[model samples]
Target: MPPPILVTGGTGTLGRHVVARLHDAGRDVRVLTRHARPGESGIEFISGDLLSGRGVDAAVAGVETIVHCASSFKGDPEAARNLVRAALRAGRPHLVYISIVGVDRIPMASPIGRTMFGYLASKLATERVVAESGLPWTTLRSTQFHDLILMVARKLARLPVVPAPAGFRFHPVDADDVAARLVEITLRTPAGRVPDIGGPRVYGAADLLRGYLGAARRRRPVVPVPVPGKGARAFHAGANLAPDHAVSGRTWEEFLADQVGDAPAGG
Candidate 1:
């Protein structure tokens, strides 16, 4: 029998898909969550909190592989450190982490870096922990998820005018696709850091907002707000895009279409 694989953040957007894929494959899958829930079917639920390191060791016991998917803009660094310690104590499991693209390129020393500091810093710290943990590990850096783009668009749509960061571009990949890749990675030997998985195409923030508005059948004028910063400069320079390595299927338009359905009858 294959050793049970423990999955942190198994209840989240991407983690849920990973759990489902692993469970369907008939693998011994265990999920860690803050609240204990009754196991359904063959899936096991282990109660644990990555932030406080509570119940973590118990969750790692007997598990040979861990897919570290749980992350927080505020607590990721500490949580990752805790998870690494627990894994080491429980016999150095193969650790796989999901990270965002362009973190390496984003300046951690500037004012722009300080703005989105929590999230970027935490994730960078987590990556370092996984790398230096002396355990077999793999880290997959992927671009922003399409759902995130939609969330921002929805929130901005509430305003009188949709304001987009000028010169900002994104290559938003689908969460499910990223999840599938993670599953594939988990089944193989750790490959350390792999090529980034990005969306089918790159689009500027204004174009993205227009796509969202078109799909939702809402008309809103997009105003470009120039955000001057090194971070913004990096994003504008395509640091967030893996054009040479555009991987994964599904485009932002496809995702929007699925979510909003067919555009209202074109006049």
Candidate 2:
């Protein structure tokens, strides 16, 4: 039998799509989850956790490639380190990591950033480990996911008026698109640091919220509130925007439209 491709965060937003892509391509896939279950037609699930190292060895065993999309916004650095240690022990050859763009440039904004902070720092740390571990690896940095906009919109909709950070810019890419890119990287040679991936268009936070309002058919006033702090500064400066090597794809409007159409009525 051939060695299967192991995917961490297999049940997550991006991970699910990645697993499906690999399965569709006829590649044997094993997904690491908290609970192990019977193989699903073409995919295998292994119960494991990166923190405690529980079932990691078994999950990684016999797998030649690993797509590491699992991450904790709170303990990303430590989580990444733990996963790398296990991967080394299991002797996996290729490691592909999904990370966010502007991790380096952005300063700590919220408590999450102050703690785990930019995914760049965590991912860079892990990338160093993978590079030095003598394992073939690829690290992909991408802009925010399109789903994030909808999430923000929903949260804001709960309030009578939407109060958002002022002057914040984002390049939101589709999760499926990012997953496809990651799978493509896995199938090819391991490039240490691939080009950054970003959405086709760049928009301010207020603009994105307006689009979301229109798509959801919810009329609400949007108020832009300027935040005071490093996080706000980073966003206002367009740190998340892609100046060069912007990997274009579906815009936020397209993604929101699809999501709104699929959602149950009155949702």
Candidate 3:
């Protein structure tokens, strides 16, 4: 039997799906979560926090490869440092990291973007550490998830008119597809800084919202507001998309339809 693989953030949006995929493949799997719920059959769960390396060491024990999905977008640099140290001590050979597209090109937008930049910066810094550590590694940078789009659309639905950030375009990929690609990366030999993953096509923020409203049969007006700043400028310029390296299966429309189902008459 192969050695157990350790997955951090196994209960998160993408992590949970990854865990299920690994289990389905019949791989010996162990997850590190702050809270371990019972009835997660065919897998082992360990309670731990990534910030202080609390249960990280034990979780990595006897594990050959690690799918490191845990992250602190707000305090990325420090979190990356701690996780790198733990992975080093455990002598793990392969480390697969999931990061966002345009981390290097786009400036931080809101507080969340600033924090996410800090986190992506930390992931980049850790990427260097893994490269220098002589351990095999793969870094996958993906576009925004479909779930993020749905969340944004739901928030916009609250307003009589939906207001969208000007010029920002998204190729929203499905989280499940991203997870599948990540798992495939783990199964194969490490490819340093793998190709960028993106959704099937590019669509502006307004287009996404309109599609959502149309699907739900809501007739809310959409207002596009352009902000003046590097972040805004970058998004308006479509900095988050990589046309040359897109590897996603589901389109944004397909994803929205799946979530919204059929629109009712006169909805």
Better of 1 and 2 by lDDT: 1
Instruction: Name the candidate, 2 or 3, with the larger TM-score value.
Output: 2
Overall lDDT per candidate, in order of appearance? 0.87, 0.80, 0.79
| Cα lDDT for residue 251, candidate 2 | 70
Better of 1 and 3 by lDDT: 1
Give the Å error, residue 158, model 2: 0.6
Q: Which ranking of candidates, highest lDDT first?
A: 1, 2, 3
User: What's the CA error at residue 166 for candidate 3, in Å?
Assistant: 1.3
Q: How do the residues 43-104 of candidate 3 rate in per-residue lDDT, one tens digit apiece?
A: 88998887777887888787888888876555555555566677778785588888888777
Model 2 quality (TM-score):
0.89
CA deviation > 4 Å runs, candidate 3: 108-134, 263-267
Off by over 4 Å in 2: 109-132, 262-267
Clashes in model 3: which pairs? none
TM-score for every candidate vs. truth? Answer: 0.95, 0.89, 0.89
Give the least accurate 10-residue stretch of model 3, judged by summed lDDT.
Answer: 112-121
For TM-score, the strongest prediction is 1
Model 1: worst 10 consecutive residues (lDDT sum): 258-267
Residues 87-159, candidate 2, lDDT per residue (tens digit)?
Answer: 7788756888887777778776577556634555666566666667667788888888988778978899888
For residues 15-100, write the lDDT of model 1, one tens digit per residue.
Answer: 99899999888897899999899998768999989998899999999888999999765878789889989999999899999998
- lDDT of model 1, residue 161: 95
